[model samples]
Target: MRDATAEKTETALDAASLVTDMAKRARAAARVLASLNAEARTAALRAGAAAIRAAAPAILAANAIDMERGRSLGLTHALLDRLMLNEARIEGIAAGVEAVAGIADPVNTVAAEWERPNGLRIQQVRVPIGVIGIVYESRPNVTADAGALCVRSGNAVILRGGSEALNSSRAIHAAFVAGLASAGVPADAVQLVPVADRAAVGAMLTAQGLIDVIVPRGGKSLVARVQSDARVPVLAHLDGNNHVYVDGGADPEKALTIVRNAKLRRTGVCGAAETVLVDEAAKDQLAPLARMLLDAGCEVRGDAATQGVDPRVKPAAEADWDTEYLEPIVAMKLVHGVSDAIAHIERHGSHHTDAIVTEDAAAAEAFLSGVDSAIVALNASTQFADGGEFGFGAEIGIATGRLHARGPVGAEQLTTMKYLVRGTGQIRP
Candidate 1:
């Protein structure tokens, strides 16, 4: 009989082999994808959208299974909402795919061109990063978005979704494959692992040469794991421990409107505001702000000052200042001004998204300039931090890292650049 250690080693070996095969196939497909012209790739995206629309019933059914399993596993209401799929949501996904198809192709375009002193012509051209692996959780929509974005940007992708989302992801992946097949694109160009094993995630992380970059779209724990263990570089989507500051010079109406939408528009999203910082000048309006959120069935936790303004406002713990709270809950604090608000956000925020609501242009600019987040907003809802809202169709995720990509990762951001040169033979002086 095999010993436990030996069995473990064999399993690890099998996982590694599986990842290696997938990566090799993906690399070969990427070469084909990179060679295809813009029209061909666009047609593939259109076809994928059509396939998704055609497969909506099957996709819905698959999502139903996932939802059932999620509930059985006792997933939180927020996660269950993310895991659920309805007819409208499926159509929205299809529309997003079509929207991506309409975006200008980023491949092979010259970003800049210059002439050298030696009469050599030089051009900076955008090109695919090649073979991207996406790891995500809950939302099966990512399966479609990541695959479409990678294909649109002329790269092959390997997707490893969370176990709770396996069935839903498979259905969407089939639609993507149909789209690729219809366009005569290699089906291997967009692959989703068949298993739900954590071993698969580890395999992708360690498959450095095989996968160019790993883009992880999930909660903090998953991103942390990928960051710590992956041999490949990671594009991290951070938790939305976001904030909105109601500046003292703020217009009260706009402040109320933006704050309400930022916090309640969709609590489960990464852009949803988790906290609010009110300028002490807005102290008179504080109770009204607390009341608005409370009326919307949101639980408001606040500091002593905020709690004093509204009896319904619960006392906040220090940890509340830093929590993501991806639900109908928000923490409120009073700041002296834009500077104090900026300090609070800098200290506790995840640097994902932050907004300042004020009619004061000076305060707005200060907040925008001071907060070093992926997305900074002025007099607008933090929910506006979406890629679609940014007119990029669908995003892989909001990258908080200041590397190759930040904010919404669209097709253009998915690519790296190369230098193209044309030179006449000139002897050195």
Candidate 2:
């Protein structure tokens, strides 16, 4: 037994060493990626997509290994589901790469220009943010998404995916590197931290001086740890307890459709509707809407007033208002008007996405302007809160941070600006 334990320890040590080595190589490859032009970057992205398509069979085989392992380990059904990949998912990954190639490259653009009085001109130019470290869980698609975004934006990426998705990520990473090599870009432009050891996260969090930014794209516990412990700046939000408010003037039919789809389309996504709010004047319309949600197989958890209308609904505890169940469970409430809706959102929402269904232009405008979040919608399903849907191709994640970037963080949002000063011997006093 002691010998077996020691062997396990040695394996863990080897895995950690491999991860550190990969990080170093990625750091070096980033320098080469940072110098590529728009043409080279686009070519690389296109090649990457082709490579992914060619390797779809191998990728699926790798994903199958992950799925088998996850199932054998008795992981949650949701997690096991996330670990499985199919033909369409592989195609989706390739399409994501192609979409990114179509978007405008962000490097070397003059964002702003101004001339000083004393023969000095200044221009803010877009530039790469250097090495980016992304730590995420169970979605293999993130590997392709993060790699394509970073390369297109002229930044090198170090992706640390969940252990269950390791083989899948590695297969995808191999395709990306091959594309980079074929396109004359540095293959190291994208690297995966290759380890299952939990300590790998510690190494990434401490790579502050080397990695410019850290994007944690996973559950609340993962995001919280990154936010609290990382030496580098992190862009993350703990939850997406998104809401849909059906205002008084909202067309009841339209409102019901949107709300049902938002909550039931894909319950596991971050943007799935966790709460539904209705204006007091529309309180009478709640029964039909509740029936719609129920008919769609959603379990409604509602406050006292709402439960009175839908006795089948479970009584919602106070904490349900702010919970991100990430399931079929939805919390609902009734509000006085748009003001109350906004107030309720501000208090319980995760500041992710909120939709307002109303014909009143003034109320819609106020809600759009007043609600401070990454994405705000007018009479749309909150499930549309995705990078692909927004035409960004694929995103690192939706940023809730007020600084640098927000919303779907595509290639453009991945870059930062630097001032270029052209001066003719201008001297300061």
Candidate 3:
């Protein structure tokens, strides 16, 4: 019999070594990737898609190994579900590559330009962010998504996925490298941390000057830890406790439909609605809405007003207000009006995505303008908070931070602007 703790510790150490080595290689590869033309980059993305599709069987097999280990370790069904990658998921990764290929390359675009009085022309151009270190959880799909987006944007990527998904991540990384080779790009452009140790994350976070940026995509705990320990710039969200407000002027049919789909369509997604705010004037509608959620097998935690409306729901604790329960359970509340609803969101929201289902233009405008969130929706589901939905094709994750970027962090968001100045022979007098 093996000691699980020791096995986990050794595995983590191995991962740290792998990530540290890969980071060095990626830094060198970034210089080469930066010089490639748009056509060459697009070709690489297309090749990546083809490689992922061709390696679906191997990817699935690797996922199976990770899944088996995860279950034996008593991982939650949610985590296990995220770790398992099937043929369809493999195809989805391929589709992401294809989508990235179609989009205009963000690199080399002119962000802004200006002419100075002294015959000087200054132009701001977008450039790759260099080496991007991504640390994520059980979702194996992120391996392909982050790898492709970084490559397309001319940045070398180093991915460190969860210990439970190590095999799956490695298999995906292999396909990505093959894709890079098919396009004649350096295989080191996409690297996966070999060890699955938690310490690997610390190594990644502290790789300050070596790594340009560290983007952690996972639960709040992982992101928070990275934010605290990271020496480099971190682009992450503390939580995804999103919300949906059904205003009094809302179309009952539309509100009911959006709420149901938002909560039940897929509770595992970060943009899934965790709280439902109903207008006080429309409080009576709660009974029917609560039934819909319950019928869909969702567990409802309600405030006093919600508990009065739906006796089936349990009383919500104070902690529930600030929770990001990525499950089929939602916090239900009744608001006096739009202002009240906005206030509630401002206080408890994770600034991820918030939607308002209202027919009143004034109320809708107020909600959209007042809410300080990355994605604000009107007459739509909070689940629409996705890069694909925004027409960016695919995204590494949504950035809730105000600096650098916000919302769905696509390829364009991954770049920084540089000033290119052209001047005649003139000196300042």
Candidate 4:
């Protein structure tokens, strides 16, 4: 008889082979997608959105199973929240897909044009980045967002969602397929890996020639693995240790409201503020802000000065400065001024998103310029650091790395620029 362990190993290898085959199919589909016009892509997205709305019952049923499994596995409340989806959330996801369809297609758009001295007309135009591999965790909405964005930008996508959301992702992917068929696009254009094996991720990471770019949308471990092991270029952020600084000139009411919403509105999201920096000059506001958080059922972790303001505040350790608490918890510290806040964020922040609540334009500008993050807000909630808020419809992820793309990875960012030079048989010197 064949060894059982060996058979399991063979099965895993087969799963890897399956993933590679999907990558190849996606590469071929990308050519077809690239030839499609903006109108055709929009039609496909709209079809997908309609399919999602029609399939809400089935999608929610799948989500319920995932939620039950998550609870049994002892997942955190935040993680479970990311996994669960209801009718309203599904509708929102569909709307986001429609919004992407409404946005102007980025492919073939002229970014720059000029005439050269050598009688040549040079124009820089955007083009699709070919096949993209999206490895995400928990959120099934990413299934719609990533597929729609890739289709809108004229690229094919291969999605590999976490096991926790496997059923919901498949349900959502079916909607995408229906949309593609409605628009006469290839079903392979947005293929999701069928197996939940870890080997599939490894195969995707190594499929350098088949996958043009890898975008990981998950926690630090997931992003770190993709960045470290993937042969393909990665566009991702390791963490969202975001911050909100209450400047001396900030309105107390604004600070309170922004902080409350930024931290507690939806704690599991990447835009949630993990740290609060209060200007020493605004010491009086500290107690009020801390009290508000306490009243809202948030656990406050603070330094000596902040802890002195409220007895409910727990003492913060050094590790809290660099942690991304995806929960109803926040770390607070008092800064000497804007400069101090900037220094602290520069040292501890994950360069995701940071905000300043200040009525003083100069102070706000200083904070905005000094802090090095993907998204910097002035008197705004850090939660506004989203692609939809930026009018991009939906985002694949927020790229914290400063390279080909930064901030939100939307349809426009999914494309690369190519030089379209026209001349009558002009040759290089």
Candidate 1 structure quality by residue, lDDT tens digits, 224-341: 8999999999988658899999988888888889999999988999999999999999898788899999999999999999899778899999999999999999999998999999
Which segments of candidate 1 are over 4 A away from where they belong?
Answer: 427-429
Cα deviation at 290, candidate 1, in Å, is 0.5
Tens digits of lDDT, candidate 4, 165-190: 99999999997788778878899999
Candidate 3 stretches greater than 4 Å from native: 1-20
lDDT of each: 0.92, 0.88, 0.89, 0.94
TM-score against truth, every candidate: 0.98, 0.94, 0.95, 0.98
Sequence-dependent TM-score of model 1: 0.98
Q: Name the candidate that leads on lDDT.
A: 4
> What's the true lDDT of residue 15 in model 3?
59
Tens-place lDDT digits, model 2, residues 119-140? 7999999998888999999999
**Ranking under lDDT, best-scoring first?**
4, 1, 3, 2
What's model 2's overall lDDT?
0.88
Model 1: lowest-lDDT 10 consecutive positions? 6-15
Best by TM-score: 1
Give the per-residue Cα lDDT of candidate 3 at 364.
96
